[model samples]
Structures are given as structure tokens and as C-alpha cells.
Target: MSDAPTTYTGAVKPGGPADVRELGGLTLTKVAVDAQMSNNCYLLRCRSTGEQLLVDAAAEPETLLPLVGENLATVVTTHQHWDHHRALADVVEATGAATLAGEADATAITEATGVPIARTLSHGDTVAVGDCTLEVIALRGHTPGSVALLYRDPEGTPHLWTGDSLFPGGPGRTTTPEDFDSIMSDLQEKVFDKLPDETWFYPGHGNDSTLGAERGSIPEWLARRW
Candidate 1:
């Protein structure tokens, strides 16, 4: 194991509304950028191995590029959405990292980003960065191919980077008529019920919360589920 420290720093663009938070570790730097007041884009770095992972490359690659550069190893999208993929082409150009998304959304991601989908991911796949691993969990509520990345801190507490699955107060929106029930069912059975109460949720939008907080809001969510 490397003996590097995990440090985080935040920076805001001069004329832009986005804020970039750089979390540095022994081998990786996890950079989270708050974009368009709602979406988030993350960059994971492996210092020892020089491998990096870019999660949900949203708009403003001009703002996100210097941090990503040649160190990027792969780009993984939680799901394919306009706001999330708008900056992908710039990222691909800068890092040459293979872009990955769910099989169900690959075509849409490709169409939206104008970049080929290099790999299709499914539930239970492990995305590795040096010795760290993020296990994929298909949430499938907000979008057909929506997924969550589950990782553990040194203490073993679960930390989830849910693309658009479960947010601070609830899960993401379901526009397709066929996805409403599946999205809610998946939330209750796969996400809310399966993960421990202590799991920290880093959603695609809003502030971070825990599974316990989200579980408590299920009734409120169900009441509004339409």
C-alpha cells in the first residue's frame, strides 16, 4: 500500500458557476466539480500507478481539463444524460481514456457525446484504480441504465456515488412511462433496502447524505411517486 495522504481542495471558476473540489489520496485524487447548480463531475487519480478515472464528465471541460490531462485512465458515466455528457468529447481528447457506460445507454451516450462507447458496464462490475475498487450497482430508476458506484473508506463504511439514482431527499426523475415502477422498485429493493444505513451517498445532484436519511424519506417519496 502507498503512504500518500488524501487531501481535498476547492476552487471556483472566475466567471463560471462551477466549483471544483480536489480530494487527494496516496495514489488517487478524487476531484468533484459542482456544475450548473445541480450536476457533479468527478475525477479520480492514482498517484502511485498514474491511473485516473473520470466520472460523469459534465459541461465545462475547458474548466475540468487541466486537472484531468494525460493521467486519465478511463471515463465512466453513471448514466447518459445531456448535462452529464456535454463535456465528454473534450475529456476523451485530453486523456484518451476509454469511455464506459451501461449497455442499455451506450447508444444514447454515443449519440449525445459523439464519442464511441468503449466498454459497456453492468451490475457487479468492479472499476479499479490501483488498489481501490468501485463496485457497480444498477439502480435503473432515473434512467434505464442508471448505476451507482459503491466504495469503502479505510474504516469500511460504504460510500456510494449514485449517478442519478438516490439524491439527498429522493431518487431522480422518471420520464419514461415504462420506467416509473421499475425505478421505484429498484430504489426500495436494490438501493434503499440493500445498503447499510451508514452508507454515505454522493448523488449526481445536491448535498451528500446517508442511507438512513434517505430511508426515512421513503414514505415521502412514495407519496409523491407518480
Candidate 2:
């Protein structure tokens, strides 16, 4: 509904889709797209199987296509926000990969992007990304159905892809007090309390942060009440 653009100058280096970074055993590639809003799209590949999972097709299908490669197994839309799905239609059309999203937002995502979501995900659901599985952690509030994807490596340290729910210093923006309360409660119980301090969260936009780094700011985030 809002077309306000956002940017993260230092959080991530905006690069072409071909750039790939190592994340423990997996390969993580990120590209920052500047459109109505600046959104960070990520592609995660299983090093062993070489299968891929595309996260948030924010914009520019041409750029995303190369990063996605030929073994894309699933395309995940973090939420139903327009900004996040801008490139979804084209990317899905090209890849023919299965699309997955939270059940509550599936209809809206389909209506907005004109791309059918192949599977509906809920809290505790696991999606296979090659040899690794991404566990869905539903975080309600930003939308009635926003969720975070978690992939735990062999060492137990988790990598989280959070879309507009939990951020670096605080929770995502909410329009009303009830929505704020809902997000705050879920984040406290489902995320901050449940996930380990070593868990690194990659947000939809901007920089990534760890639970350990943000643990001390919970009280401040709560006190601000925004």
C-alpha cells in the first residue's frame, strides 16, 4: 500500500547476481535492488547438492535469473508486500520452480503477483532446500502471516531469513498498537526467547544481525513502543 523506498548503504554491498558469498557450508548470494523500495534478494545454495532456494524475488528478473542458476527448487516470498514480490512473476515463470509462502498470505500474494504459490507454509513446517531444510517460524504482526525461514547447519548455529518481521535493533514497523503488541509478543516468545544468541537473522532489507548482538536492546525496543 505504501511505496516508500528504503535503502541500506552499508548493510550489504549491492552487486550483480553472479556474486556469491560463503556461509558456512552453504553459498549465499545477495543483490540489492532499487525500485519503489530498496529490497535485498537472496539466493541460498546447498554446497553438497548444488540445489538452490531463492528468497524474496524483490526486483529485476534479469539479475535474479543468473544468481538463481538452473537448479532452483523453491522460490520463497517472505510476505505479501508488493515491494517484495516485484520480480516474482517473471522469476517464477522463468524458473518453473515451486513457490511457497505462509497460508494466510498465499491468496494475497497470488492476487498481487499473478503467480500461484505452490505450497502453503505454517509455523514449524520444514521446506527442503537440497540436503538442508528450512524451518518455518511464523511471526505474526507485520501482516497476519509473516514468517521467517531458518536453516540450521550441522554445527547448530542457525541462519534465519526474516522478512519484515524482526530487524537489527527492533521489530518491523506496525501501523497500530494492536499490531505492535502482536508482533512484540510473537518476537519475544517465538524468536528472541526461542532462538539461540548465535542465530544470525537476515532481514528483507538492510543489514543482518545476530540474536546475541540484539539481546541487550530488547528493553529499549520495548520501551520505545513503535
Most accurate candidate by lDDT: 2
**Each candidate's root-mean-square deviation in Å?**
3.9, 6.2
Tell me the tens digit of each residue's lDDT in model 1 across 1-226. 2222233222233233443333333233333444345466666665457677877887677767886777788888889878778888988988788888987888999988899998898988888876677788887858788888876655346667888877777778887655767777887887777789987667776566789876887887778774
Off by over 4 Å in 2: 1-10, 13-19
Instruction: For model 2, give the 10-residue run with minimal summed lDDT.
Output: 1-10
lDDT of 1 at 118: 89
Error of 1 at 3 (Å): 15
Which regions of candidate 1 fall more than 4 Å away from where they truly are?
1-37, 176-178
lDDT of 2 by residue, 46-147 (tens): 878998988998887877887786778889999988888888988888888899999999999999988999999999999887788888989888988898
TM-score, each model? 0.83, 0.90
RMSD of 2: 6.2
Candidate 2, number of clashes? 0
